[model samples]
Target: MSTCRTGTGPLTAAELEDWYAVPLGRADGTWVRAGLVTSLDGRAAGPDGLSGSLNRGSAGDHAVFDHLRRWADVVVVGAGTVRDEGYGPLPAVPLVVVSRSGDVPARLRRAAESGTRDGPAVVVLDGHGEDVDPGRVLTEVASRGWRRVLLEGGPQLLGTWLEADAVDELCATVRPVLVGGDGPLLVPRSTSLRAPVGSTTHLLAWEGDVLVRTRLR
Candidate 1:
Protein backbone atom coordinates (compact mmCIF):
# COMPACT_ATOMS: atom_id res chain seq x y z
CA MET A 1 0.00 0.00 0.00
CA SER A 2 2.91 2.23 -0.59
CA THR A 3 3.04 4.95 -3.26
CA CYS A 4 2.22 2.76 -6.19
CA ARG A 5 0.85 5.57 -8.44
CA THR A 6 -1.71 8.35 -8.44
CA GLY A 7 -3.82 10.44 -10.82
CA THR A 8 -4.23 12.83 -7.90
CA GLY A 9 -1.41 11.84 -5.57
CA PRO A 10 -0.09 13.59 -2.49
CA LEU A 11 -3.56 14.34 -1.14
CA THR A 12 -2.73 17.44 0.86
CA ALA A 13 -5.11 19.73 2.75
CA ALA A 14 -5.58 21.76 -0.41
CA GLU A 15 -6.06 18.61 -2.47
CA LEU A 16 -8.60 17.13 -0.07
CA GLU A 17 -10.65 20.26 -0.33
CA ASP A 18 -12.53 20.18 -3.68
CA TRP A 19 -11.12 16.79 -4.54
CA TYR A 20 -7.74 18.28 -5.42
CA ALA A 21 -9.85 21.15 -6.69
CA VAL A 22 -10.75 19.12 -9.70
CA PRO A 23 -13.97 20.50 -11.12
CA LEU A 24 -16.13 17.51 -11.93
CA GLY A 25 -18.73 19.20 -14.08
CA ARG A 26 -22.41 18.60 -13.50
CA ALA A 27 -24.59 16.28 -15.48
CA ASP A 28 -28.23 15.15 -15.69
CA GLY A 29 -28.54 13.41 -12.32
CA THR A 30 -26.85 12.90 -9.00
CA TRP A 31 -23.24 11.81 -8.92
CA VAL A 32 -23.16 8.59 -6.91
CA ARG A 33 -19.87 7.61 -5.33
CA ALA A 34 -19.44 4.57 -3.12
CA GLY A 35 -16.98 4.36 -0.24
CA LEU A 36 -15.95 0.88 0.74
CA VAL A 37 -13.04 -1.08 2.19
CA THR A 38 -11.76 -4.61 1.85
CA SER A 39 -8.98 -6.90 3.01
CA LEU A 40 -5.95 -7.73 0.94
CA ASP A 41 -7.53 -11.07 0.13
CA GLY A 42 -10.82 -9.30 -0.77
CA ARG A 43 -13.40 -9.67 1.99
CA ALA A 44 -15.85 -6.93 2.85
CA ALA A 45 -16.55 -8.34 6.27
CA GLY A 46 -14.62 -10.50 8.70
CA PRO A 47 -15.71 -13.22 11.17
CA ASP A 48 -17.38 -10.42 13.15
CA GLY A 49 -19.70 -9.54 10.23
CA LEU A 50 -18.44 -5.95 10.09
CA SER A 51 -15.68 -4.00 8.33
CA GLY A 52 -14.07 -2.74 11.52
CA SER A 53 -11.39 -5.41 11.53
CA LEU A 54 -10.34 -4.58 7.98
CA ASN A 55 -9.87 -0.98 9.01
CA ARG A 56 -8.24 -1.82 12.37
CA GLY A 57 -7.82 1.86 13.28
CA SER A 58 -6.37 3.06 10.00
CA ALA A 59 -6.55 6.78 10.54
CA GLY A 60 -6.01 7.59 6.87
CA ASP A 61 -8.88 5.38 5.81
CA HIS A 62 -11.07 6.91 8.48
CA ALA A 63 -10.16 10.35 7.19
CA VAL A 64 -11.19 9.30 3.70
CA PHE A 65 -14.50 8.07 5.07
CA ASP A 66 -15.09 11.39 6.77
CA HIS A 67 -14.17 13.24 3.61
CA LEU A 68 -16.69 11.24 1.60
CA ARG A 69 -19.38 11.96 4.16
CA ARG A 70 -18.60 15.65 4.02
CA TRP A 71 -18.56 15.60 0.23
CA ALA A 72 -22.01 14.06 -0.05
CA ASP A 73 -25.30 15.81 0.39
CA VAL A 74 -27.00 12.62 1.51
CA VAL A 75 -25.68 9.28 2.73
CA VAL A 76 -27.42 6.20 1.35
CA VAL A 77 -27.00 2.78 2.97
CA GLY A 78 -28.70 -0.55 3.15
CA ALA A 79 -30.74 -1.56 6.19
CA GLY A 80 -28.56 -4.55 7.04
CA THR A 81 -25.52 -2.31 7.25
CA VAL A 82 -27.36 0.02 9.60
CA ARG A 83 -28.16 -2.89 11.90
CA ASP A 84 -24.77 -4.60 11.72
CA GLU A 85 -22.80 -1.37 11.93
CA GLY A 86 -24.94 0.01 14.77
CA TYR A 87 -25.08 3.48 13.29
CA GLY A 88 -26.40 6.59 14.97
CA PRO A 89 -27.18 10.10 13.70
CA LEU A 90 -24.83 11.80 11.31
CA PRO A 91 -23.42 15.27 11.81
CA ALA A 92 -25.45 17.37 9.33
CA VAL A 93 -26.69 15.10 6.57
CA PRO A 94 -29.77 13.00 6.04
CA LEU A 95 -29.63 9.22 5.67
CA VAL A 96 -31.55 7.30 3.03
CA VAL A 97 -32.24 3.68 3.89
CA VAL A 98 -32.94 1.73 0.70
CA SER A 99 -35.27 -1.16 1.46
CA ARG A 100 -38.21 -2.89 -0.08
CA SER A 101 -40.35 -2.19 2.93
CA GLY A 102 -38.73 1.22 3.52
CA ASP A 103 -38.42 0.39 7.16
CA VAL A 104 -35.79 2.20 9.17
CA PRO A 105 -34.03 1.29 12.39
CA ALA A 106 -35.71 2.77 15.43
CA ARG A 107 -32.47 4.39 16.53
CA LEU A 108 -31.98 5.92 13.10
CA ARG A 109 -35.55 7.10 13.02
CA ARG A 110 -35.09 8.72 16.42
CA ALA A 111 -31.85 10.26 15.29
CA ALA A 112 -33.55 11.70 12.24
CA GLU A 113 -36.37 13.08 14.34
CA SER A 114 -34.27 14.62 17.07
CA GLY A 115 -31.69 16.19 14.86
CA THR A 116 -31.51 19.33 12.78
CA ARG A 117 -33.52 19.73 9.57
CA ASP A 118 -31.66 16.82 8.05
CA GLY A 119 -33.60 13.56 8.27
CA PRO A 120 -34.27 10.21 6.62
CA ALA A 121 -36.34 9.91 3.47
CA VAL A 122 -37.76 6.57 2.50
CA VAL A 123 -37.65 5.21 -1.07
CA VAL A 124 -39.31 1.83 -1.35
CA LEU A 125 -38.36 -0.30 -4.33
CA ASP A 126 -41.36 -2.52 -3.95
CA GLY A 127 -41.67 -2.87 -7.71
CA HIS A 128 -38.39 -4.81 -7.76
CA GLY A 129 -38.99 -6.96 -4.70
CA GLU A 130 -36.00 -5.95 -2.56
CA ASP A 131 -34.03 -5.06 -5.68
CA VAL A 132 -33.44 -1.37 -5.24
CA ASP A 133 -33.80 0.61 -8.46
CA PRO A 134 -30.88 2.89 -7.76
CA GLY A 135 -31.79 5.03 -10.73
CA ARG A 136 -35.12 5.88 -9.19
CA VAL A 137 -33.51 6.68 -5.87
CA LEU A 138 -30.90 8.92 -7.49
CA THR A 139 -33.53 10.59 -9.63
CA GLU A 140 -35.55 11.40 -6.53
CA VAL A 141 -32.50 12.77 -4.77
CA ALA A 142 -31.33 14.74 -7.76
CA SER A 143 -34.71 16.35 -8.22
CA ARG A 144 -34.28 17.79 -4.75
CA GLY A 145 -30.84 19.13 -5.69
CA TRP A 146 -29.08 16.70 -3.39
CA ARG A 147 -26.86 15.77 -6.28
CA ARG A 148 -23.82 14.62 -4.34
CA VAL A 149 -24.88 11.17 -3.16
CA LEU A 150 -22.73 8.73 -1.22
CA LEU A 151 -23.68 5.09 -1.06
CA GLU A 152 -22.00 3.68 2.06
CA GLY A 153 -23.25 0.22 1.67
CA GLY A 154 -23.67 -3.37 2.55
CA PRO A 155 -22.30 -5.45 -0.36
CA GLN A 156 -25.73 -6.64 -1.48
CA LEU A 157 -27.03 -3.12 -1.94
CA LEU A 158 -23.94 -2.05 -3.81
CA GLY A 159 -24.20 -5.20 -5.90
CA THR A 160 -27.73 -4.31 -6.82
CA TRP A 161 -26.79 -0.80 -7.84
CA LEU A 162 -23.83 -2.04 -9.78
CA GLU A 163 -26.02 -4.45 -11.69
CA ALA A 164 -28.55 -1.74 -12.45
CA ASP A 165 -25.83 0.42 -14.06
CA ALA A 166 -26.53 3.17 -11.59
CA VAL A 167 -23.25 3.97 -9.86
CA ASP A 168 -21.25 6.91 -11.20
CA GLU A 169 -18.01 6.06 -9.40
CA LEU A 170 -16.61 3.82 -6.68
CA CYS A 171 -13.99 4.87 -4.15
CA ALA A 172 -12.33 1.98 -2.41
CA THR A 173 -9.53 1.25 0.05
CA VAL A 174 -7.81 -2.12 0.08
CA ARG A 175 -6.20 -2.83 3.42
CA PRO A 176 -3.27 -5.18 4.07
CA VAL A 177 -5.13 -7.88 6.03
CA LEU A 178 -6.59 -10.94 4.40
CA VAL A 179 -9.82 -12.21 5.91
CA GLY A 180 -11.42 -15.57 5.16
CA GLY A 181 -15.09 -14.67 4.94
CA ASP A 182 -16.50 -14.11 1.42
CA GLY A 183 -13.34 -12.16 0.49
CA PRO A 184 -14.15 -8.43 0.50
CA LEU A 185 -16.61 -8.42 -2.35
CA LEU A 186 -16.97 -4.86 -3.61
CA VAL A 187 -19.90 -5.30 -6.01
CA PRO A 188 -21.22 -8.82 -6.35
CA ARG A 189 -22.89 -7.84 -9.62
CA SER A 190 -21.22 -10.87 -11.14
CA THR A 191 -19.57 -14.01 -9.75
CA SER A 192 -16.32 -12.07 -9.28
CA LEU A 193 -14.94 -8.54 -9.17
CA ARG A 194 -14.98 -7.69 -12.86
CA ALA A 195 -13.15 -4.78 -14.41
CA PRO A 196 -15.16 -1.69 -13.54
CA VAL A 197 -17.67 -0.77 -16.25
CA GLY A 198 -15.44 2.17 -17.08
CA SER A 199 -11.99 2.04 -15.49
CA THR A 200 -10.16 2.05 -12.17
CA THR A 201 -7.74 4.87 -11.40
CA HIS A 202 -5.43 5.01 -8.42
CA LEU A 203 -6.08 7.94 -6.14
CA LEU A 204 -3.34 7.56 -3.55
CA ALA A 205 -1.80 5.22 -1.00
CA TRP A 206 -2.41 6.07 2.62
CA GLU A 207 -1.17 4.43 5.81
CA GLY A 208 -0.30 1.14 4.15
CA ASP A 209 -3.61 1.06 2.33
CA VAL A 210 -4.45 1.73 -1.30
CA LEU A 211 -7.13 4.25 -2.28
CA VAL A 212 -8.56 4.08 -5.77
CA ARG A 213 -11.50 5.35 -7.79
CA THR A 214 -13.43 3.59 -10.52
CA ARG A 215 -15.63 5.47 -12.94
CA LEU A 216 -18.84 3.59 -13.59
CA ARG A 217 -21.87 3.70 -15.84
Candidate 2:
Protein backbone atom coordinates (compact mmCIF):
# COMPACT_ATOMS: atom_id res chain seq x y z
CA MET A 1 0.00 0.00 0.00
CA SER A 2 1.27 3.46 -0.87
CA THR A 3 0.88 6.54 1.29
CA CYS A 4 -0.45 9.81 -0.09
CA ARG A 5 -0.97 13.00 1.87
CA THR A 6 -4.42 13.61 3.34
CA GLY A 7 -6.38 15.92 1.04
CA THR A 8 -8.48 15.86 -2.12
CA GLY A 9 -6.97 13.66 -4.84
CA PRO A 10 -7.69 10.69 -7.10
CA LEU A 11 -7.29 7.02 -6.11
CA THR A 12 -6.81 3.97 -8.33
CA ALA A 13 -8.42 0.52 -8.12
CA ALA A 14 -5.18 -1.00 -6.87
CA GLU A 15 -5.01 1.57 -4.13
CA LEU A 16 -8.59 0.73 -3.11
CA GLU A 17 -7.93 -3.02 -2.83
CA ASP A 18 -4.76 -2.49 -0.85
CA TRP A 19 -6.72 -0.50 1.73
CA TYR A 20 -10.06 -2.37 1.83
CA ALA A 21 -9.34 -6.04 1.24
CA VAL A 22 -8.61 -8.04 4.40
CA PRO A 23 -8.32 -11.78 3.65
CA LEU A 24 -10.20 -14.01 6.15
CA GLY A 25 -8.81 -17.30 4.66
CA ARG A 26 -12.29 -18.72 3.79
CA ALA A 27 -13.13 -20.70 6.94
CA ASP A 28 -15.93 -18.54 8.24
CA GLY A 29 -19.01 -19.70 6.31
CA THR A 30 -20.64 -16.33 6.88
CA TRP A 31 -18.38 -13.49 5.80
CA VAL A 32 -19.97 -10.44 7.45
CA ARG A 33 -18.20 -7.26 6.39
CA ALA A 34 -18.95 -3.57 6.73
CA GLY A 35 -18.08 -0.54 4.52
CA LEU A 36 -18.44 2.80 6.23
CA VAL A 37 -17.42 6.41 5.52
CA THR A 38 -17.05 8.82 8.41
CA SER A 39 -15.76 12.34 9.04
CA LEU A 40 -12.76 13.23 11.18
CA ASP A 41 -15.22 14.15 13.93
CA GLY A 42 -16.88 10.67 13.59
CA ARG A 43 -20.27 11.62 12.18
CA ALA A 44 -21.84 9.02 9.87
CA ALA A 45 -24.88 10.91 8.70
CA GLY A 46 -25.77 14.43 7.64
CA PRO A 47 -29.19 16.06 8.23
CA ASP A 48 -30.38 14.08 5.24
CA GLY A 49 -29.88 10.34 4.80
CA LEU A 50 -26.89 10.83 2.47
CA SER A 51 -23.28 10.59 3.60
CA GLY A 52 -22.44 13.55 1.35
CA SER A 53 -20.41 15.19 4.08
CA LEU A 54 -17.94 12.31 3.78
CA ASN A 55 -18.13 11.93 0.00
CA ARG A 56 -15.39 14.44 -0.65
CA GLY A 57 -13.11 11.91 -2.33
CA SER A 58 -12.29 11.78 -6.01
CA ALA A 59 -13.93 9.25 -8.34
CA GLY A 60 -11.78 6.63 -6.61
CA ASP A 61 -14.14 6.24 -3.63
CA HIS A 62 -17.11 5.72 -5.92
CA ALA A 63 -15.19 3.07 -7.85
CA VAL A 64 -14.23 1.40 -4.60
CA PHE A 65 -17.90 1.23 -3.48
CA ASP A 66 -18.90 -0.23 -6.84
CA HIS A 67 -16.17 -2.85 -6.60
CA LEU A 68 -17.22 -3.83 -3.10
CA ARG A 69 -20.88 -4.10 -4.08
CA ARG A 70 -20.03 -6.18 -7.15
CA TRP A 71 -17.65 -8.51 -5.28
CA ALA A 72 -20.23 -9.60 -2.75
CA ASP A 73 -22.73 -12.35 -3.53
CA VAL A 74 -25.42 -10.71 -1.40
CA VAL A 75 -25.86 -7.25 0.09
CA VAL A 76 -27.32 -7.21 3.60
CA VAL A 77 -28.74 -4.17 5.37
CA GLY A 78 -31.07 -3.40 8.21
CA ALA A 79 -34.67 -2.51 7.51
CA GLY A 80 -34.28 1.02 8.85
CA THR A 81 -31.19 1.72 6.75
CA VAL A 82 -32.78 0.29 3.62
CA ARG A 83 -35.65 2.71 4.03
CA ASP A 84 -33.40 5.64 4.88
CA GLU A 85 -30.83 5.07 2.12
CA GLY A 86 -33.40 4.27 -0.59
CA TYR A 87 -31.27 1.34 -1.79
CA GLY A 88 -32.00 -0.75 -4.83
CA PRO A 89 -30.83 -4.18 -5.81
CA LEU A 90 -27.56 -4.71 -7.67
CA PRO A 91 -27.59 -6.09 -11.23
CA ALA A 92 -26.00 -9.44 -10.39
CA VAL A 93 -26.13 -9.63 -6.60
CA PRO A 94 -29.12 -10.44 -4.42
CA LEU A 95 -30.40 -8.20 -1.60
CA VAL A 96 -31.04 -9.43 1.93
CA VAL A 97 -32.54 -7.60 4.88
CA VAL A 98 -31.90 -8.62 8.49
CA SER A 99 -34.86 -7.68 10.59
CA ARG A 100 -35.65 -8.96 14.04
CA SER A 101 -39.28 -8.22 13.40
CA GLY A 102 -40.89 -9.68 10.30
CA ASP A 103 -42.23 -6.28 9.30
CA VAL A 104 -40.68 -4.70 6.17
CA PRO A 105 -41.55 -1.14 5.16
CA ALA A 106 -43.55 -0.42 2.00
CA ARG A 107 -40.89 1.76 0.35
CA LEU A 108 -38.26 -0.96 0.72
CA ARG A 109 -40.49 -3.49 -0.98
CA ARG A 110 -41.01 -1.11 -3.88
CA ALA A 111 -37.31 -0.28 -4.19
CA ALA A 112 -36.38 -3.96 -4.12
CA GLU A 113 -38.86 -4.81 -6.84
CA SER A 114 -37.70 -1.91 -8.95
CA GLY A 115 -34.06 -3.03 -8.70
CA THR A 116 -34.67 -6.65 -9.73
CA ARG A 117 -36.87 -8.12 -12.37
CA ASP A 118 -37.99 -11.14 -10.34
CA GLY A 119 -38.12 -9.36 -6.96
CA PRO A 120 -35.99 -8.65 -3.88
CA ALA A 121 -35.47 -11.24 -1.14
CA VAL A 122 -35.93 -10.50 2.54
CA VAL A 123 -34.24 -12.34 5.43
CA VAL A 124 -35.67 -11.80 8.89
CA LEU A 125 -33.49 -12.95 11.78
CA ASP A 126 -35.89 -13.96 14.52
CA GLY A 127 -34.16 -13.83 17.89
CA HIS A 128 -35.36 -17.31 18.73
CA GLY A 129 -34.63 -18.62 15.20
CA GLU A 130 -38.24 -19.81 15.22
CA ASP A 131 -41.81 -18.52 14.58
CA VAL A 132 -40.56 -16.68 11.48
CA ASP A 133 -40.35 -18.48 8.16
CA PRO A 134 -36.73 -18.56 6.99
CA GLY A 135 -37.38 -21.09 4.25
CA ARG A 136 -39.62 -18.75 2.30
CA VAL A 137 -37.05 -15.94 2.37
CA LEU A 138 -34.15 -18.30 1.63
CA THR A 139 -35.92 -19.77 -1.37
CA GLU A 140 -35.51 -16.50 -3.25
CA VAL A 141 -31.95 -15.61 -2.22
CA ALA A 142 -30.62 -19.19 -2.09
CA SER A 143 -31.64 -19.89 -5.68
CA ARG A 144 -28.89 -17.45 -6.63
CA GLY A 145 -26.34 -19.38 -4.49
CA TRP A 146 -24.96 -16.40 -2.55
CA ARG A 147 -22.38 -17.65 -0.01
CA ARG A 148 -20.69 -14.35 0.77
CA VAL A 149 -22.81 -11.61 2.36
CA LEU A 150 -21.77 -7.96 2.48
CA LEU A 151 -23.24 -5.97 5.33
CA GLU A 152 -23.68 -2.25 4.73
CA GLY A 153 -25.07 -0.62 7.81
CA GLY A 154 -26.00 2.56 9.68
CA PRO A 155 -24.33 2.10 13.08
CA GLN A 156 -27.16 0.24 14.82
CA LEU A 157 -27.13 -2.75 12.49
CA LEU A 158 -23.33 -2.88 12.46
CA GLY A 159 -23.36 -2.80 16.24
CA THR A 160 -25.82 -5.72 16.30
CA TRP A 161 -23.54 -7.85 14.13
CA LEU A 162 -20.50 -6.95 16.19
CA GLU A 163 -22.32 -7.84 19.41
CA ALA A 164 -23.32 -11.18 17.92
CA ASP A 165 -19.67 -11.78 16.95
CA ALA A 166 -20.86 -12.49 13.43
CA VAL A 167 -18.61 -9.97 11.67
CA ASP A 168 -15.48 -11.43 10.04
CA GLU A 169 -13.90 -8.33 8.53
CA LEU A 170 -14.38 -4.58 8.41
CA CYS A 171 -13.56 -2.16 5.57
CA ALA A 172 -13.88 1.41 6.74
CA THR A 173 -13.05 4.81 5.19
CA VAL A 174 -12.01 7.55 7.61
CA ARG A 175 -12.40 11.04 6.17
CA PRO A 176 -10.82 14.22 7.47
CA VAL A 177 -13.73 16.43 8.44
CA LEU A 178 -15.65 17.19 11.61
CA VAL A 179 -19.42 17.61 11.68
CA GLY A 180 -20.48 17.24 15.27
CA GLY A 181 -24.20 17.04 15.85
CA ASP A 182 -26.91 14.72 17.12
CA GLY A 183 -26.01 12.50 14.16
CA PRO A 184 -24.85 8.89 14.20
CA LEU A 185 -21.27 7.69 14.58
CA LEU A 186 -19.44 5.08 12.49
CA VAL A 187 -19.75 2.29 15.09
CA PRO A 188 -22.07 2.19 18.09
CA ARG A 189 -21.01 1.03 21.51
CA SER A 190 -20.87 -2.77 21.89
CA THR A 191 -22.29 -3.84 25.22
CA SER A 192 -21.61 -7.52 24.55
CA LEU A 193 -17.87 -7.29 24.18
CA ARG A 194 -15.81 -6.77 27.31
CA ALA A 195 -12.53 -5.99 25.59
CA PRO A 196 -11.76 -3.34 23.02
CA VAL A 197 -11.94 -4.32 19.34
CA GLY A 198 -8.75 -3.83 17.37
CA SER A 199 -7.97 -3.38 13.68
CA THR A 200 -4.89 -3.16 11.43
CA THR A 201 -4.52 -0.09 9.22
CA HIS A 202 -3.97 -0.70 5.51
CA LEU A 203 -3.51 2.77 4.05
CA LEU A 204 -4.87 2.78 0.51
CA ALA A 205 -4.87 6.43 -0.54
CA TRP A 206 -5.23 9.95 0.75
CA GLU A 207 -7.69 11.91 -1.32
CA GLY A 208 -10.12 14.72 -0.62
CA ASP A 209 -9.29 14.81 3.06
CA VAL A 210 -10.09 11.10 3.43
CA LEU A 211 -8.17 7.96 4.34
CA VAL A 212 -9.73 5.22 2.24
CA ARG A 213 -9.50 1.81 3.93
CA THR A 214 -8.57 -0.03 7.11
CA ARG A 215 -9.06 -3.65 8.21
CA LEU A 216 -10.42 -4.84 11.55
CA ARG A 217 -7.75 -6.62 13.57
Best by lDDT: 1
List of clashing residue pairs for candidate 1: 42-183, 42-184, 43-183, 43-184, 44-184
Query: What is candidate 1's lDDT per residue for 1-217, written digit by digit as tens?
Result: 1222374334666566645222363565457888898877767876687877667777767877888887788888887787778765665676777776656677665555555333444332333355667877877787767888889988888887777776778888888787775544755636333453756544677767877776765
Instruction: Give a tens-digit lDDT track for model 2, residues 1-217.
Output: 4333233335456755554555563453435567777777777775564665456543555666677886777787776676677665545666777666645666455554454244335443433433223343334444567656677876777776666665666766666667777788777644366565645444455444444443333
TM-score, candidate 1, is 0.80
Candidate 1: C-alpha lDDT: 0.69
> Which lDDT value does model 1 have at 153?
85
Backbone clash count, each prediction separately? 5, 5
Which model scores highest in TM-score?
1
